[model samples]
Target: MAGIYLHIPFCKKACHYCDFHFSTSLKNKEPLLKALAQEIILRADEFKDKIVETIYFGGGTPSILAVDEIKNIIKMLRENYEVIQVPEITLEANPDDLTDDKIKELAQTEINRLSIGVQSFGEKELQMMNRAHNAQEVKQCLQTATQYFDNITIDLMYGIPGLSNQEWKQNIQQALDFGISHISSYALTVEEGTALADFIKKGKYPAVDESLAAQHFDILVELLTQSGFDHYEISNFGKPNAYSKHNTSYWLGKSYLGFGPSAHSFNGDIRSWNVANNTKYIKSLSENQLPSTQEILTIKDRYNEYIMTGLRTIWGVSLNKISKDFGLETSAFLEKQVEPFLANGTLVLKQNQLKTTQKGKFLADGIASELFWV
Candidate 1:
């Protein structure tokens, strides 16, 4: 099944370590939303009639939109696309924007899932990240959201410099206490040109301790597992039957349509992304021209993608599927190469699937890179 991802390229403030494309200005929100609707209608033919199993409203903060604005987009999707009868519609929201009234309004929409950004349960860390929400708001927002929504997932950050292991433990406990069925926890990474990077350069903030980050990751694995959450992806944990279908589709290499600035869309072989500039994207779409660049994945690129995605999930890489898709020789090469990691207890060979062991999860990216086809 296919999916749709709409990027609302606007935020109230910039987080220090964020490298995503977003504007702090709401000057073009209205026009951009309309343009996005048009883009969806215009590009409906791309999917050829695949049922959309998920529709994700992700961004700077989709919760900022009014009830009517959100409903309009849902209406547009229903009219243009072959959406699943009970599609997983998720909206990524910041805690500050999740007022009771807003949550109630959102509950009335076709949107069935809420992914709240509750980065940390520490006020000090929240300020350090320049996040718009405070620790208290995270609890209140989740409590309010639970009143109306059951399919909820929360985004959390871990291993911020100066955030002690105890504090990280508190954050995990807080998420569990809130009764959120799904969680996406990630380590803090300083991207180039981000304020956090500059601060580290100036010795204003401590450099990210890789050792400390690893410790925190281990804590996450232990706690989440004890709490009955499956470590479905390296960063995502879910209770039984609560995995994120939208993101899972991406990892599984299923095709999806992405609308709005900085959004990327994929159809079997080609991938395309809209311009990162919100103004440029809106202007071009207003003129009835979609501003996007396209790339066709070579066989090597496809095989690399498969290897990268397969190793990160519980499902693992299917050697038989790889042989069928890429050729027997390529699969044989991977089988031989992976034997070393398997011998080291970092990889496992079960049935026809090749999966990473628990010890291999933290170094998943490095391991995936080694398996990449030239």
Candidate 2:
């Protein structure tokens, strides 16, 4: 199966910690939407033989678009591609953009899921991050959104400087009170070139404490698991059968096509991404050409990716599949590399599957990196 992703590269405001490709200006919004539709039609042949089970509208901020604009994109996909009757169409939104009227309008369309970007529920934390929404808006939006969308997911951020454990616990409790099905929580990372990074460099903002982040992570895992949510991935918690189909498909290495500026696409072997510059993306699409670069995956590259993704999810890396796909020598090398971790109780071999123990879940990425074929 395959999935489709559309990246809306426009945001109303720039957050302090964000490094994703986006423009605060909407000068190119109209032309960009037209180009996105054209890109969809131009790339239809890639997924002609496959069925699209999920369509994700990721952002800068997808909720910035009007409902009709979203509908037009869906119409184009339906006409050009073999989409399933009830595909899981998700739109990533900000709490500020999701008004009562907006929520009602979205329910009328084919979009079935909403992934709200409610980073935190603390006003001081929100202001520190320069978020467009306040704590009240988060509450208002969730109260309205939960009434309309059952398959809703909200994002939360931990590891903010000066945000105490008590405040973080309150954030988790608030989200649980909303009764949403899925939660995507992430640590506050300081990406280079972002405002947060600049602040830290200038001593305007405090540096992130990794030890505190680890404590918050442990709290999150304990709380969510106690609340009957599955810690399906390192950063995701979901109710039974409520996992994100689009993201889960991506983690499983399923083929997907991404449209718009700075979007990435993958078939089984080759991965491609569009130019990050909006003007250049528009100019190339205007000339009926796809402005993207691609890389063909080597066997080693694929194996490493499998190991990385496998260890992060509930489904660990399969030894038998590794042997079948990468040959016995590669499998043997993996076995040898994983010996230390297995002996340290970080990983265990259950039914020929190398799965991480709870002790290693927080460090899954590091463990996967150690097992990578160099």
Candidate 3:
């Protein structure tokens, strides 16, 4: 099965810590949508033979568009691609944009899932992140959203400089209070070139503390797992059978087509990304051209990718699969490299899968990098 990702690269305002491609102005919104539709038709042949199980509307802010605009794009995708009869169509939305009318309108569409961007419910944290919504909006949106959709997920962030562990726990509890089925929580990382980075450089914002973030992460995992949510992926928690089908397909190395500016696509061997500039993306597609760059994955590249994604997931890395796919030499190298982690109780070999222990879950990325095939 395959998936489709459409990037909506327009936002009302820039978040202090955001580094994703997006425009603050809506000047090119019309042209961008047209280009996006054109892109769907342009790339239809690639996935003609594959059944599209998911269509994700990810973004700078997908909710920035009107309901009709989103519907038009979905209609275009259906006309061009062999989308399944009941695909898991998800739209990433901001809390402020999800008003009662908007939520009801979305419920009437083919979109079945809603990934709300409710990073934090704290007022100070909201202002610090330059989010448009306040705490009240979060509660209002979820109250209304839960009424309309069942397969809902909300994005939460921990590790804000002044956000204490207690506050972080409260944030998770607030989400649980709403009966959210899936949650994607992340630690706040200050990316270079973002406003948050500049603020820290000038002492305008406090630096992110690694120890505090780790503490918050521990709290997150313990609370969510106890609340009956599976920590299926390092950054994601889902109730049983409620895992994100689109993102799961991605981690499992399934083929997916991404349309619009700054989106990426993968088809097993080669990975490609569209240009980040909206104008350039639209102009290229106006001429019936795809503005993207691609790379052919080397055996080492594939193996390293498998290691990175595998270690972060509940499924873990399969030793037998690695042996069959990457040969005995690479498999042996991996086994030797992982011995240290296994000996330290950071990883365990269960059912031939190299799974992370609770102690090693937070450090999964670092451990995976050390075991990368050079």
- Per-prediction TM-score: 0.98, 0.99, 0.99
Clash pairs (backbone) in predicted model 3 = none
Task: Please give the range of 10 consecutive residues that has the lowest summed lDDT in model 2.
Answer: 354-363
Question: Can you write out model 2's per-residue Cα lDDT over 62-142, one digit (the tens) per residue?
Answer: 999999999999999999999999999999999999999999999999999999999999999999999999999999999
For 168-252, candidate 1 gives per-residue lDDT tens digits of 9988998898888999999999999899999999999999998889889999999999999999998999998999999999999
**Model 3: residues with Cα > 4 Å off, grouped in runs:** none
Sorted on lDDT, best first, the list reads 2, 3, 1
Ten contiguous residues minimizing lDDT sum, candidate 3 = 158-167
How badly does each model clash, as a count of residue pairs?
0, 0, 0
Clash pairs, model 2 backbone: none
